[model samples]
Target: MKKSQDDAKSLQERALRLLARREYSYAELMQRLSRFASKDVVEEVLDHLSEAGYQSDQRFAEVWIRNRLQQYQGEQRIRYELRQKGIARERVDQEILAANPNWPELAAALYRRKYGEMLAPSREEQAKRMRSLLNAGFSYDQVREALKHLDSEAEFD
Candidate 1:
């Protein structure tokens, strides 16, 4: 009984230390703690931390979204990353809506930052640019809008 209590205390301490550095989703915390203890023990500690309001999936999601936006990542990429972190789809959607990102503007801005004002490139060059944007998680329409914006800007220059 004493050993069990000590183990739980150690686990809680480890969890608190991790939480102190940055927000972690419950699942992330579980995964990290599982390496140190059994699933039941990890769950118990996580539950306690959560009850104490030291761990929050909502806060984790919000911070993650904000950081991703600062990196100029698109919505699809952010959603996929949050899902991989075990955030529920409903919560992901709610946080995304709360963030209220302007997807088209962001896409255009990302394109401008990456490619600059050199317009009317070769067909191959255009395809390469499209691929880069698509891989960055922009959808077809969003990529097209960005390219269109680029073309218009080039015309003005």
Candidate 2:
């Protein structure tokens, strides 16, 4: 019917407006569009947009990874976030592998930016630093390497 056609058109318009603002994963767009229309309508509109190359999970994943890296987030955090956004595990792994960031160096850089040079940090201070790095999604090995490298630098200074 005309009403259904209008609904699809409006949904497509809304989707384009959103895409104009930023890249959205298909899952994200679905969540957003579902609020306004039925699941079938939203899916159809999204499928059309996807076919038109206006929506892409792969592009969304790539852009998301790049932005997170600029914020100095680690691979684990990026992977978790991408998954939360409905990106598949294989896609997440592939994008992360494509990124190929240096984990230890990134951790060390983040640490240096945050805590600075600590000539004689106490055990408590060390623990705090380790916790911060871990929470930032750095692996144990990466966190240890970061602290060890910084501690040695501080000792020499």
Candidate 3:
């Protein structure tokens, strides 16, 4: 009984410490806590914390989305990453759609920053640029839109 109480206290403290640094998804917290405590204890602590509002998947998703947006990541990659973090598909879609970022403009801006106003002079170069943008998580439509205006260089000043 004493050992159980100690374990419980330790788990809660560790959890609080982790949460203090930054937000964590439920699965992330559980995986971390499981290293120190039993699965049952981790579940109980997580439930209590969640009920008390210390842990929220919704909040985690919102912040994660904003952070990824600054990195100019596309929706497909963002959705995949959020799912990997244990957010449900419905919630992920809701959060992403709700944010409603202009993906085409974003893609164009990123393309300008990387390749500049110098047009791809050959078919191979155009295909290579397309592949780069696609690998950076853009959809085909967004990449095509970005390609159309490559000559209009962005004014950084």
Candidate 4:
């Protein structure tokens, strides 16, 4: 019995170590830890980590949103991903807008990255670019605002 308890403790510690290296949402932690610990043990360790302030979904969401947006120009795609990661919807929204994302800027940057330039020389090209932006998870308004004399050469960072 004592050996079993010690093993559980060890697993928990290893889980925390992995988490400390980088942020992990609750669901992410479970997915990663399940390999080393039983479902019940994983849950127990998660609960302990939560109570001890070592794990916080709110913080995870906030950091994830900030990092992804800055690194990837993530918009709705990242928002949905965070929800899937078990972050509360409200918290995800709060974190996403915490830095007040420049929607037009992000859209322009993403558009430029996916397409060569905002103003296509031909209507067909413009339409194709528009479709690409939409598929990249940008809203119509965002695409319009971004493409309205948008320049990708301007660095967002």
Candidate 5:
């Protein structure tokens, strides 16, 4: 019993260390700590932390969304990332819809950063780039709109 208790404490401490470095969704923390704990202990510690105000899904979601936006990742990418972290799809969508990120502006900024002062690629090239952008988490319409502006002028003020 003592060994079990110590192990649980250690997992909590390690989870805290990780959280201090960066916000993590409750599910994410559990997944990471579960390597060191049983499923039941992981759930108990998570519940304790949550009740003590040390863990929060909404706060985690907010910070995750903010970081992704800063990195120019669109809602599609952010949602996918959150799901991969074990956050519910509904929660991810709720946060993304609430965010309503400016994909057009973000895509434009990313395009400019990567390919400044160069002509937009040919339609075939642009299509490939578009696919890459989509894979990077942008929507089809957002890519089209951003590329339209980019193709219009190699040098945008």
Candidate 6:
């Protein structure tokens, strides 16, 4: 019993130190703490942090989404990344919708930045640019809207 108590305290301290540096989702905290303690102990520590309002998956998701958006990443990539971090699909969708970004416009700006104000003269060139945007996590609609004005010099703005 004493051993378990000491382990819990140690895990708590380690968790606190990590949280001090940055917010962590419950899943992330558990993965980190599980390396040093049992699953039960890690869960208990995480529960304690949750109760104390030290760790929050929602907050982590929000911050992570914001950071990724600032990096001009697409919604698909952001959703995938949040899911990989153990955030729920519902929560990911909720946060993304709340951000209210203009996907088509963002896609246009990204394409313009990468390929410049030049139009793809050949079918092969157009296909290559389309492939690049699609691979960058843009939806078909967004990609289409982005390339719709490929000949317009002021399309990027």
Clash totals in order: 0, 0, 0, 0, 0, 0
Provide the TM-score for each candidate, comma-separated: 0.93, 0.93, 0.90, 0.81, 0.84, 0.88
Cα lDDT tens digits, model 3, 78-107, are 898999999999989899888998887777
Model 1 lDDT per residue over 1-157, tens place? 8987898999999999999999999999999989888899899999999999999999999999999988788889999999999999999999999999977778778777887767546999888888887877878898888778778878898
User: Per-residue lDDT of 39-137 in model 2, one digit per residue for the tens?
Assistant: 999999999999999999999999999998777788789899999999999999999899888888889888878877762358887788788888888
Worst 10 residues of 5 by lDDT: 112-121
Clashing pairs in 6: none
Best first by TM-score, ranked? 2, 1, 3, 6, 5, 4
Q: What is the lDDT of candidate 3?
A: 0.86
lDDT of each: 0.89, 0.89, 0.86, 0.78, 0.81, 0.85
- Number of backbone clashes in candidate 5: 0
Off by over 4 Å in 1: none
Alpha carbon lDDT of residue 126, candidate 2?
78
Per-residue lDDT over 78-120 for candidate 6, one digit per residue giving the tens place of the 0 to 100 score: 8888998888899889888888888877777778788887767
Error of 6 at 28 (Å): 1.6
lDDT of 5 by residue, 1-157 (tens): 9998998898888878887898888888888888888999999888888898888887788789989898878768888888888788888888888887779878887776766645445877666777777877889899888877776765554
TM-score of 1: 0.93
lDDT of 6: 0.85
RMSD of each: 1.4, 1.5, 2.7, 4.0, 2.4, 2.2
